[model samples]
Target: MKGKYVEAKERLRGSIAPLVTPFKRNYEIDLDKQRELIEFQITNGTHGISVTGTSGEPSSLTVDERITVMENAVKTIDGRVPFVPGTGSVNQAETLHLTKVAQEMGADAAMVIVPYYNKPNQQALYNHFKTVADSVDLPIIVYNIPGRTGVNLEVNTLARLVEDCPNIIGVKESNKDFEHVNRVLLYCGRDFLLYSGIELLCYPMLAIGGAGSISATANVEPKKVAEMHNAWESGNLEKAQNLHFELMKLNDVLFKDTNPAPVKAALGMMGKIEPVLRPPMGLPSKEVLKEIHQTLIEYGKDVQNTFDM
Candidate 1:
């Protein structure tokens, strides 16, 4: 466990791409395309890979499918970078099962999201994460995205978990409230890792002692996203700030619809993957597509010949 902690502490920094799950037009999970996406991140300078995250549509996948995604990611990454898979679910049993699988599969850590829809209170959230943390030897990163989860794991609760659970190492904060990030850092100590799950907040978070980001924007502009982190780490704040502004439009466009949809469309336009989405998650409207197309073009992506404008 100490070795796992040390390894994760060292490697789980910088622009970790929360990869979107690629699907065929028939809507099957595309393992081949998944490998291609992982390779794309590795070749383009992303520091790490986070599979089956919010962008990967884990809610849409079965347990077996989610495990397969993690397996494929671990195999494809092949020690070139750290692999942290989202092994969380609304069901605690399922979360435990998936997280255990990730630990066995050589994942660097397990990202367990706050249980959604049920809106469990802080104590329940603490017990919930504590159970999972104790059940696995891997480092645990608590994922708090209250917008989607319908419950915010407060700073005090997180501080309690950190004190009680040795393996609960960090957090992926997706909330818009920057104060929550500050409070978590203040309470947990500065070395406690915080990765921004919000694209727009990535640079700002990094500026405030955040470890890195699990940015969806990295799906399109891996090099630029990674360079922003590298620039900041190397003390080039002006370059980092410029890249932050440069990425703002693309970041906004990615969330224009319901995420992954616009991001998938952008990837499709670039000929990287098919823009297929699962049921209940459809592609963006034509207007949104046009905006996405133009945004990609403005970012210097080769989308001029791809979409019918």
Candidate 2:
């Protein structure tokens, strides 16, 4: 491996928090809050930082908005940690453009998700990823979230992309199917970097040789999340496993509604961010909010006293 790719592979592991694109109540992009969130993640010991991924609501943001988030993240992170920005969209041109922007801005890696909504076939999937990978010099982490994309990235297809594009170094498996994730490392080789995107599988994936996670749960509990990875890597399996089971409820509640909504609400109750989500992605229901509030209290987060009943 080249020196740069080798360094990225080493540094990009662990709890890479897929950040929420914080918005004001009026639905404006809150860059200032975004920076604050970045600082929060860093201070709390997050291993790396990723923005504009599933948790960040990429579909809702304009191309320019995505670019702006990448620029902001690059500036704020400032070499403190590895930065991997979500640079994929359903449109090929947009994906290429955003990825190029990320590389130009000096991101450590670019996570290109499977083109959603189109439901492209394996060959098409291979082609789409290879083209994007070929377009940039940065390491590319193929994001396979079949649930949202309506198309699964077969292991063979991913293997082919890895073979074809040298820069395509790893995959972020947001998939729930453990078998599929197993096959990816099996076929792609144990050296292939697999980062878990599923909150529940974060530790298990590590046990199975995954590099780390880009978990949404990290948005609420960066310290513990990063600690889970840190513990496992440090050979403290018992501690890591305990944290894994400990985080299960938080993981469950955060996803009780669509992502970012529940996570945003949790952050809001904690007074970290405003807890506002964009249109078509509102705050969690009163019922879910109450559950989240109670969950936070149990988890020892200082949830605000003003939580509505």
Candidate 3:
């Protein structure tokens, strides 16, 4: 388990794009568009592909739909780079089942988010991860997004989980508290892979020895995001910092409304995917759409030609 953790720690470092699950106008999962999106990421230099993540709209997806996405992603990725899928759900059985399926389907790792709605205490959080980690041979990257989950997985609790679960090798730190990221690294040892799930913190986290980031901004700007990481890794701090600032607005725009909406709109304008979203999640507001249009145009996207409005 320790060896597997170390191997994954070494390989899973860089800009991992948490891909959006493309939906048709009728809201069916567009598997063909999903493949095209994956190819775009790979062609543009993304180091990894994380499907069915927060940006992928996992909560609204049925278990079978989620599995289908994972299967298609693995098949499409085809060993080009690492494939990590979001497998966690509010239900433990579902989480375990998805993780097992990810393993069976040849995923490089599985991202299990903290259970939402239930808001488990720190001990329960630890136990929840422990049970999943124990059940699977695949490396587990704990997804700690307290904003969505309603409870923060504290540094002490996280370090404890690492100490106890050898297969629990990394974390996607999505909270706004930068101190939490530093504390996790300080306590868990630098070898424990830490990825910034917050776009604005991506470069800063890497500067502090984080493995990499899973940026929703990458959905539209994979090259720029990959270049930021590549620049930093190559020790071009000036170039990396410049790219970070360049991407700052797009990151902000993505969450101006709820996630994936703005991003999906951006992709729609770029002709990468249709701007459709599932029920309970809708398109960006008119004001946000205008902002997205203008931003993409400024970013060199041909919004005038491609976006139908």
How does each model score on TM-score? Answer: 0.98, 0.98, 0.98
| Total clashes for model 2 | 0
Error of 2 at 86 (Å): 0.3
Compute the lDDT for candidate 3.
0.92
The sequence of per-residue lDDT tens digits that candidate 2 reaches over residues 130-245 is: 88988888999999999999999999999888878878889999899999999999999898899999999999999999999999999999999999999999999999999999
TM-score of candidate 3 relative to the true fold: 0.98
Give the alpha-carbon lDDT of every model: 0.92, 0.92, 0.92
Worst 10 residues of 1 by lDDT: 300-309
Instruction: Give the count of colliding residue pairs in each prediction.
Output: 0, 0, 0
Q: What is the lDDT of residue 261 in candidate 2?
A: 90
lDDT of 1 by residue, 34-90 (tens): 999999999999999998889999999999999989999999999998888999999
- Off-target runs (Cα >4 Å) in candidate 2 are 305-307
Any residue pairs clashing in model 3, and if so which? none
lDDT of 3 by residue, 1-309 (tens): 567667888899899999999998888999999999999999999999999999999998999999999999999999999999999999999999999999999999999999999999999999999999999999999999999899999999989988888888899999899988999999998888999999999999998999999999999999999999999999999999999999998889888998888999999988888888898989877888988988998899866333445
RMSD of 3: 1.2
